[model samples]
Target: MQEPQSGPDRRMFLRATAATGAALTLGGLSTQSASAVAPGGFPDYTYVRTLLTPSQLKYNPTGEIIFPTVRGVYDKLASPLGRYYLYYAPHDAPGGICLAYGNSLEGPFTEYPANPIVSNKWDSHYSVSHVSSPHVLWKEDVKEFWLYFHGENTTTRLARSKDGIHFTYDKVVLNTSMMPAGTTETSYARVFRHDLPERGASYVMLFMTNNTTDHRDIGWGWSADARTWTFAQTPLVRHSDVGAINVGGPHLLTRNGSAYVVYNKDKTSGGDIMITEVGKDFSLRKHLGVFYDSRSSAPENGRAAAPSFGTDGGVPYMIYEAGERLKGAIAVARG
Candidate 1:
């Protein structure tokens, strides 16, 4: 059977456009192009991050190998320790326990301290939900680092850090879900982080959200100031054709001059990657195609956090989620 495709239907797009006119005008995201795509915005898979097939790493009962489904990663300063911090619902000796890593994108990755970094004690946000989807970025201009994560129940949490690994714990930024009242309980969430590039005149916060229904879609809330965020009130991508079942990890990527969002879609547990691009102002976007699909091993399922991208020598790579039997192991794929 063919996998279900996801996108915004014409009627839904028309309705969303009419409802958020004022917000778009005020936020400056109204530069919608009816016919022009930003100079280079197309979502296509460059390459997938793969595992080294190290002897130290072995497969579990499912007989499928494991890897790091690095939901989020960022190089804060230059390189080395500050080079990359991979976060997920981490998988290791225990699995779905905490954040872990690989020194680089390809690994032989291990857990951090062999335990959960932040746990249920973080229950302040949502008593039942756990922390997932971490987006980390450093801002040299303000001399501060920011960690953006979402709890299972709450929309998202924003924290600042003087150093990359540790945070101030000062206060939760954007302490509320952007979901509409009637849809709050049935929704997935809104995950956002401002990926500020020092040279770029504008900043982009790649995010995912669901206004109503089961995982309606994922998108970003764009902002120039980084203080006031304008929810695309519309998702950057939609799974309208994906049968209202599953879609996750809509991490943003840019190539040349365009923007692309990557995600996984599975009616089952172990899922695969999906890519799509946005129009100049997100007024128009298209599902380029599926990069990877299907279960490699067994007991296949949907996916986990996001994937991290980097280059080895000169080849591009990615780290994502893979599951077999009882393990939702982080796995990699390459061109």
Candidate 2:
């Protein structure tokens, strides 16, 4: 069955118009676009420093990590969890959900004592070869933290926590079963809160799905609550759309009233971030081209993937994996 599609909303366009109000000045250069997009339209970010490498972590059992999901601890009661929590894991066998903490966005973070808070083996609940690509969302209405991760590269699972450290495993939220026929893998998901009231979904998720042909594309779903989800019959963005061998690491960037999907594409030259503007209906509307290129950066070593955006002291920053796949460092960049 097909999902209902939303018509062009005048308010959405109006909001989009408002989003183009001002361009941001990045690195002594004006990189803003006239189009309605996030201010500065994905900044001309300057590489800052390597925030964390597997070797830096005191308790990196896997000796590798990727997909950094950083969130601020707002509630005063969560003082023990530090001001900020950075969640990441290895996309290898026995993958886990691990965390680090710090007071500042540009972190000198310390790994949690009880690292790998959630492991591949959960006994009666579920067990898989590896669990990686962690995306955590703080549910304000419920006053709880919800973590979404994938294991076996086929199933995306959910686990909730009151403390953001100790988690209670929830059921698998998405897998190949919910996708179109001939689909092989469904993983690398990121969720966001959007203003699409017409869709009847307060939250939306963007994920990477691989087909029988091994082509990777972006898949999407919607939910009123953060738990249950209903995905589109097809991908939201395709490798062919961007002329890439594969595309993953989906991130939702909403500014003013406009929404954009920023993801990494595997190009012959190297991996780089790309952006596409999506309508309020959650449909891919336009390809905005390369958001961040990594070929010139020596630290990135011709590759950058899985970007997580944040702002520190009003300056926009990105936390992403820099270097080759499975052999990279968690890097921080500011603009």
Candidate 3:
């Protein structure tokens, strides 16, 4: 995601890709045909309903929310937050890390009374202009939720919590200084626990990194404990590889020992989600075309970005940022 400016200019955020010489298109998996599965085993989802909009947030500081991701607690008895914790935040100024909770994946998620668990202003520790694009991972070994988000556009910070609500500020896991020379911004990160051969790392992170040329691509890193990370010399996926002007909001999808980066692109037709199979080694493989067709759905408004996937009661589901850039709502789909 591009850095949102203050006020009306915030819409300018992300003036915003695939492998294979030829992009592969999966046919018959229309959003309307929610029951069918795509050729490559992609879920053909039917848009259920708007899970959340900025307007629904009782204490929306910026009047907008972009990232919608959830993590299910194994032992609700031990977890104080709830059965499911939804994390989202505004991509605008004074952006904050907010929360909501529900008993089910298909939710009546109630916002936390004192929201912005991690506000932009933290005296003595640190303070920034804004912070948004939250991605949370529940580490089973440590029994803690690792929250990754960005502030000041160039830095991605980390925080940890046992209960999923109260967070202890960790350290900066990613920054532009760690990126390639031409890189300008790095944020909107999604981290996954995947083992890579020869790297001896237990986790991998994929994120949006912009260049001086204003091109956004998916950059990556490998981490041994989800705290410290080592960045790659190059990006995982480039805009040109997928015929997109820009791409961001990366989520990792693993199935049958294969890894795919699910991200959104900026195109003439409007932004839609696309997938690229980056195998276990994180090697750029094939472009699996339109993971979710935004053009066909009314909720999408010809745009869909930042997708997060999960399962509830043995059913697969996707929740994503839908509608225009910055001015969008969170929509849910199930197959």
Candidate 4:
């Protein structure tokens, strides 16, 4: 792990741009005007419907467990064919990468008949142990989908898929050995492929890692080809500043030229979805504040975390895990 660099030059550039009220651009995507902040202070997200629950999933009845206990749903990615792909892990069973599908973003998703698309046996390192927090990326240049996930919450791994359903294991991308000594583990990675000439790299990853104190924070890495990575030793988003003990499960969204990282900040009751602006170089910029909270009054819906963003018919949507870990349901929200 490399120590976080104090980016004075980059900060100066961003401050200058904001002072002049100039739109930022990256990879042809224009930034929003200074006046166009998130509507209603934060995104007015309304609950749509529940997408998945442990009882609702289609799993092998004769398998080790009758109904697999879900730890949490990781993320969702959309296909050009109008299907939404969701990744999750079963707590009791093999706990590998499982796949589910639905036609609508706010859907009654069906678990793939051939689920656990990528199992623990696929990787020789952490075979049959645990693999979770899968974030998939669609590489337009190669017309293939790449999956980034963690095994045993200690190593970040990669795999590739041709049709976004079946996947082939690639290699371990990040682990404790790659970080500074005393780094306990690394996991929950969110990757983005941007076209920012100033950054000198195209691929950026925001992930979570624990230090000797077992404190989790968001770290980052950059890659030119989306394969090999160079990780930052220090955290990109710290828990102290975010007002959360554990900050993980990062998701990236880019609009106009501005980029945002939507992640969960653990709270005593549950968790809240928070958003923060990210620099073109994938550095943490400004914290935009909480976007959603699942702890309701009437029909309480425990913790809500692990957010994944998508769109249907040009309408923005979000899918997240609601309830306690290992006993949660995947829910959807629309703007």
What TM-score would every model get versus the actual structure?
0.64, 0.86, 0.87, 0.78
C-alpha local distance difference test of each model: 0.47, 0.80, 0.80, 0.67
lDDT of 4 by residue, 135-221 (tens): 888877786788888777779888887777777778888888888898887887877877656656788887888988867888888
Best by TM-score: 3
Worst 10 residues of 2 by lDDT: 1-10
Q: For candidate 3, lDDT tens digit of each residue in 1-335?
A: 23332211221221110121222223433122222343256766657788888877787776678988888875733745667788988989899998888877777778898888888877666788999999999888987889999997999999988888889998888999998787889999989999985898989999999989998999999988888899997888889998999999999888787888889987865687888998878866688777776744566888888988878898888888888877888888775
Ranking of all predicted structures according to lDDT, beginning with the best and ending with the worst: 2, 3, 4, 1
lDDT of 2 by residue, 244-332 (tens): 99999999987556788889998765688888888667654688777776745556887889999877678788899898888888988
Model 2 lDDT on a 0 to 1 scale: 0.80
Model 3 CA lDDT for position 272? 75
TM-score of 2: 0.86
Q: 104-136 in candidate 1: lDDT tens per residue? A: 555556645544444434435434234555555
lDDT of 3 at 163: 83
